[model samples]
Target: MKIIWTFTLMMIPGVVSSMSVTGYSGGGVNITCEYDKKYKENTKYFCKGDWLSCIDRIRTDIKDKWFDDGRFSLYDDTRSAVFTVTIRNLTEEDSGTYHCGVDIPTGIDSSTEVKLKISTGQQTRTVRGYSGGNIIINYKYELIHTNHVIDVCKTSSDQCFTVINTNRSTEWKRDRRFSAHDDTSAGLLRLFIRDLNENDSGEYKIIVKVSEDYSFFSEFDLDIKTDDCCVKSISLSASAGGSVNINCKYPQSHSGDVKFVCWRSGADLCAKETPVNESRRWRDEGKIQLYDDREQQLLTGSISHVTEENSEYWCGVQTDQGHKIFITRVLVSVTDTVGPAAGWPVWMGITVACVTFIIIIIIIIVLYKIQKKRINCRSAIDEYENYPRTDPRTDPRTDPRTDPRTDPRTDPRTDPRTDPRTDPRTDPRTDPRTDPSEDTYTSLDLNTRSSDLYDTLTTVHPRPAVHQ
Candidate 1:
């Protein structure tokens, strides 16, 4: 006995006039319908319905019947009018016969049938790209029944690209992974690993199948690192009247095989020395020079008679990979003095001698004035003793001879000369010998005691006295 089952389908108003099935349970199915047959002028079989109308009808009426528990659902490419049924979460219960049918308005209808048989094991496939624009495919593990094949489509620009797998041991095993054909490409095919692990870090092989019989392959390695280059430290030093030196060291990771070294001050790099090149006189305004050279060590050239102008001197080094720089400064000053040309001790002695000479001249002038006063007093006394007597008759001041009356009676004991007033043969007042007007004393002979004595002796003693 045979049992027959019939399922009724429903349609949405105004949008759909027909229904059909596009794909089935174990993956082999094809369905088509007449949405716009006028698009193909001679295709009279598909003349009446719009494309959206046909798709809407299939989605509404047949979608529930095709559900197969939770394994399948309806999909439509709205831009292309292609309706598809996708199977997922597959199970053995989903296997069945599918009927696709479309109802025409003039009492006519079209139908097609597809059979589905679900397999018990998993089937695997891979995608790859190749050189010369080809894709290579190798399928492992047999399916319970043959499944329909479709090209791996690039939704963008509708251009088909390829991928490749080169491991022969896993060529027939569906567990093998997929990879791009060439590691380096003119256009890169970026493979994004969601949660990358250590297993993701090695070389990857890519193969591309150009046609059913031809293929290409390449390999590439990926390396991962966690550390970066760093500057270790820098230092500077300067001495009086000398060039400053600056030292800079970078971490070993960054300094590994330095090719060349350079020095700079501020933004300008110092000129280098060569075998044929002569040294530039006073280069960089006499502020910089080449000092030393070697694999990793350097020194600055000697700077003579350094001055304030060199205060801003700097040093630097350049390596194969990077550059480092530093600066140092030096300061200088000189001594000075003030006062008299001679030292203070010599000036003090000269000032003292000048003061002593002036004091000696003042003492000599005081002694000379006292001696002159005594001489003047003695001369005045002598003039007083020689003054004539006051009586005019005997005063030499009147007759000028034997004038005892005119001469002063000087004390005999004091003067020791004979006093004119005490003469023996002369009268005090009237005697001729003593008279003030007589010439007796004036004419007296030195052999006679007096002129009167001579006259009397001659008269008394007679003429014989005169002859004797």
Candidate 2:
């Protein structure tokens, strides 16, 4: 049967009048049609269904591709008198006759018929699993009277990973973690993989016996999720020179075997430095103290006088007496105690600033008003003092003391001091001799001088100077 099937496939397309092709349902196939050189420039086409009358079409001269004709495609090369036809997503209904034709202006066009057979089989179904879990797969079919042999092989090589048969007495055998079973009456073949792992995910080939020498194969893509153990982290805040207490606890599990702790800076992973409990304690007692509380499943560590350098720390929990554990990153915020102002709430600080600004604005407005009023009053006083009421008494041109005469030296009666006519003291009213009361008082005073004054007066009055 194998030799006959191979010979049949090798004889395809040997004759130009007709050919036969094979395709898998839900798969694709390509076929080539040859013609005489004289039809190279003529119009070429791909026609589907009955050769006498076809519905699906692609014209070579119009554009050589038939992409819009459903899943059918045709490419015509006029220079070589050859056309290639490609079909995709084949179905059982697509198994029929198809024509590669050339258009002739006169009479009917010549064509070659192609017999297509679309063989369909079951596709491999997907199965998923996580690490540390079991996965089961069934490869079953209808019961048939043929020798039943099923082999599940990895696609990477031609080797059976697990095999199942109806004749073998020792049927179920285990290889690695894989096992298989066969139910001949129900046409069922099942496979089970215990404790699936990440590396088990890949392409697997399922091969089955269709005949004594002929068989079919399928493929499956398996994907297994990785077992993830995420490390958790936490944050803490403390003042400088203060002590901090840390606790690491986890959910209840199969074992309360957690008994260790570690600490580190910068990176978040803990560094286990303490020895077993039977040995001595950690020598660095002043800075750190660690304890394990089995009753409460609590692991505690205390750090004294913590500074900014204590910012990065790692706390961890052990799930077993061995090295299996999980860690958490610790972030400590070490700050200083500021003054009392630093404790003030946000709203209070804003309120005080607003009030101070308002008071300053009011004071500035008051001072500006007072200064403006002073400047206005001084300006009014200066304007009034500048124009002294235009009084004639102060004018040099109109006052009597200012004199109407242009030249005082030309005045006719000017005195020695101011008068131009006579001596200032020669006025009879100013002379003592002209005053009768003045002569009486003067003649009586100093009797001896009066006698000489009277004799001189008598000589002047009597002797007008005898002509001498």
Best-matching candidate per lDDT: 2
Off by over 4 Å in 1: 1-71, 75-82, 123-140, 143-468
TM-score of 1: 0.21
Q: TM-scores, in order shown?
A: 0.21, 0.27
Clashing pairs in 2: 413-420, 413-421, 414-419, 414-420, 414-421, 415-419, 415-420
Report RMSD for candidate 1.
Answer: 33.7
In candidate 2, what are the lDDT values of residues 48-107, reduced to their tens digit?
776656755566564344433566666666666677666656679888887777777875
Off by over 4 Å in 2: 1-90, 94-122, 157-170, 227-468
lDDT (10s digit) by residue, model 1, range 134-167? 1122222222112222122121232223323223
Cα-based lDDT at residue 289, candidate 2: 62
